[model samples]
Target: MIRIVLIGLWICAVALGTLFFTVKSHMPASGDAGEKASYLGGIDYATTDVFSVPIMTDGSVAGYIIAQLIYTVDIKMKARITVPLEYFVKDEIFRQFYGSYSDTKQVEKVDFERVRKSAIDGINRHFPEPVVRDLLVEQFTFMPSSEIREMNMKSIGKRLSEH
Candidate 1:
């Protein structure tokens, strides 16, 4: 019985090897459809313009956080990936940022990936398919209300001084 099993295994291996070589020889070349093929399946990614989201605390914009995100989706869904989606993405990132650290003052110091999964899920809601391969926080700045006011005041002052 052992000898018979060994012979059968050897024959199966040889057959598979022969089939592989035959198929390989007849297959199309690598570059034949390179242009038409997508590196990441058939999905293309869209990037959102830099946008800021309000970090709410007690029904107010406790802090402002800005982020640029990237997503992979079908081209047909480009329109859906617009302002609404941008707002959602920003909200998601803010939720993660705020939940992890209540105070936005430590936004830069807080670790983002801790809430990465949730943030990614929040962003992926726009796409029916889970095409969000990853979420990248290209730019993240967490500024407290005071700083924003100060910046605004400075800009106003600069304009007034110039005039």
Candidate 2:
């Protein structure tokens, strides 16, 4: 009975060690291929939300903020932008811009032309030279005003916490 118990314990230890090693070996390192793919100016995948403010005729600004999400499947490949949010709010726009829509397609050329120039202008202000080859919006929808307010609240909370 004692011998059997000892053998069981030994088996468990070996199994655990093997499992740990396997998981560690498969883990991605900072300098690995996956990390390399995430760097800017390289062929990497990134998804981020962008906000645009549209000026209304009455001197009051309304947000035509679009949540721009993109994914690069291959290097130097034309990635798809999925617009998941497109809504006109009185003041601000806040919502998850991706994964909320069923459609996944590129933004129309006319729409792209309008937004791209604005985006380029915005980027140029911060960056000395433009880095983006093209800008595309995959999916677009509307976000509620309440959502934008909530996001503002959250930002305020964060700032308060930092101090």
Candidate 3:
């Protein structure tokens, strides 16, 4: 009876060890997990803060364009950029919108494809290599100056009434 009990305990230990080893072998290594963390292994996204630009028409302020953008760059290439990408993005957006005013004055018909291509090209031109992969519009909107003034007035009125 004592020998049988000892043999049964040994068999249980062996089975547990085999199960542990099997699970361990099937599990991903630490290095593999790290690689998976960066699913886009080579590409990374850089997002810009919300910014606004005044659209000029006939040498005066027409309205304002508010925008926020996200751009993609190769993770390796991003390290090579010395200046913040926001500068390029904002400049491109301004140039595109402001420049269009001279041609048509109406931004409603703006071609998004052209803007995307232009932004990518414009940013790439400043770099030694084309580091900017693509541009994505997170927010692109136009608010007339009158609408802004009206909104501000309403806000002020509400605040005064609360007091």
Model 2, 10-97: lDDT tens digits are 9999999999999998776756566554654454544455554332323433323355544332234323323211221111123222
Candidate with best lDDT: 3
What overall lDDT goes with each candidate model?
Answer: 0.68, 0.46, 0.83
Q: Please report, as a residue range, the 10-residue window in candidate 3 with the lowest summed lDDT.
A: 99-108
Task: Give stretches of model 1 more than 4 Å off.
Answer: 1-28, 31-41, 57-60, 74-88, 94-101, 125-128
Comparing 1 with 2 on lDDT, the higher-scoring candidate is 1
Clashing pairs in 3: none
Better TM-score candidate (1, 2):
1
Segments in model 3 whose C-alpha atoms lie over 4 Å from true places: 1-39, 102-105
What TM-score quantifies how close candidate 2 is to the native fold?
Answer: 0.31
lDDT of 2 at 130: 38
* CA displacement after TM-score superposition, residue 116 of candidate 3 (Å): 0.9
* TM-score of candidate 3 versus the correct structure, residues matched by position: 0.72
C-alpha root-mean-square deviation, each candidate = 15.4, 13.7, 7.2
Assess the local accuracy of residue 62 in candidate 1 as a C-alpha lDDT between 0 and 100.
82
Best by TM-score: 3
Model 3 residue 3 lDDT?
A: 100
